[model samples]
Target: MPPLLTGSLYDAYGSYALVPAPLPVVAATALVLTATGVRRAVSHRAPAVAPH
Candidate 1:
């Protein structure tokens, strides 16, 4: 059961709808991966200047 759905809400779903239950997990994983990749690329774009 996904955290967003309560017991009552989850219970309302029929067997057919259960097939797509993993969609949310897949979407969340993709979002996390994209954010991490973007953050890494941006952070490494410039180097710190060395002191004389």
Candidate 2:
């Protein structure tokens, strides 16, 4: 038996109590943008092979 609450059960809001705030947002955004760019670059750089 546990106390029922709203949102996440693990208390995500409490995380800010330990984190520096902006650091987390910036890190997450950078990671997503990097992944998107890398995927696009790889797809565009592929070479087509022709039968000899």
Candidate 3:
């Protein structure tokens, strides 16, 4: 029983057809990974202000 199908709460998915069960988690994980990779690259690109 998925949450979107007539659960305790009313969701906008009522009008949509064939919603993916794993889509939300998959999308969130991808977003997190992308953000982390970008942050790491930007940090390495910063110039060193102090002598080694």
Candidate 4:
């Protein structure tokens, strides 16, 4: 019974610890995607070559 309780507690703590790990990755991906989209939009609107 003691071992079972310990395992359950360990599993709970491990799960809680893992919960916050992906947040930064998700935020960074969103930022990169947004920046890429904005850059593409701006590029498409501007002329390809500048005239003197």
Candidate 5:
């Protein structure tokens, strides 16, 4: 089983919703991926300069 499966299952039961069971995992993954992508893009945009 996948790691997120357990959390998603718990969420499903806790909320008593059957249709949106995977919502939490999907949202979390999207948020994490977006943040990572932004960080990488910003880091690559400019180079650091050394002090004289």
Candidate 6:
């Protein structure tokens, strides 16, 4: 597998390098974000109880 970004950009006067994140890091980040979103949604949908 290749990194998300590759190669460099060149312009009339200068060149810039492109760095890509490792696949594992990207996957981990996505998983965490998704879990957080799902958790928030579930909590919002759950009913709240009141104590006497």
Instruction: Write down the TM-score of every candidate.
Output: 0.52, 0.51, 0.49, 0.53, 0.54, 0.51
How many backbone clashes are present in model 3?
0
Question: Over the stretch 1-52, how does candidate 6's per-residue lDDT look in tens digits?
Answer: 3422333223322433333334578889999999999999998895878798
The digit string of per-residue lDDT tens for model 4 on 1-52 reads 2455546755878644555555788789989999999999998896779688
For model 6, state the Cα shift of residue 10 in Å.
13
Clashes of each: 0, 0, 0, 0, 0, 0
Q: If candidate 1 were superposed on the true structure by all CA atoms, what would the RMSD be?
A: 5.0
lDDT of 2 by residue, 1-52 (tens): 1233323333767543434435677789989999999999999986988899
Residues 1-52, model 3: lDDT tens digits: 3664534233555543445555788799989999999999999997969978
lDDT of 5 by residue, 1-52 (tens): 3557656766867643453666787889999999999999998987778899
Which residue pairs of candidate 4 clash?
A: none
Q: List the residue pairs that clash in candidate 5.
A: none
How high is the lDDT of residue 22 in model 5?
62
TM-score of candidate 3 against the unseen true structure: 0.49
Which tens-of-lDDT digit does each residue in 1-52 have in candidate 1?
A: 5555545455677434564667789899999999999999999989879999
Model 6 weakest 10-residue run by lDDT = 4-13
lDDT of each: 0.74, 0.63, 0.68, 0.72, 0.74, 0.60
> Which residue pairs in candidate 2 collide?
none
lDDT score at residue 42, model 4, on the 0-100 scale? 95
The runs of at least 3 residues in candidate 1 whose Cα sits more than 4 Å from the true structure, single-residue gaps closed, are: 1-16, 47-52
Give the winner by lDDT: 3 or 6: 3
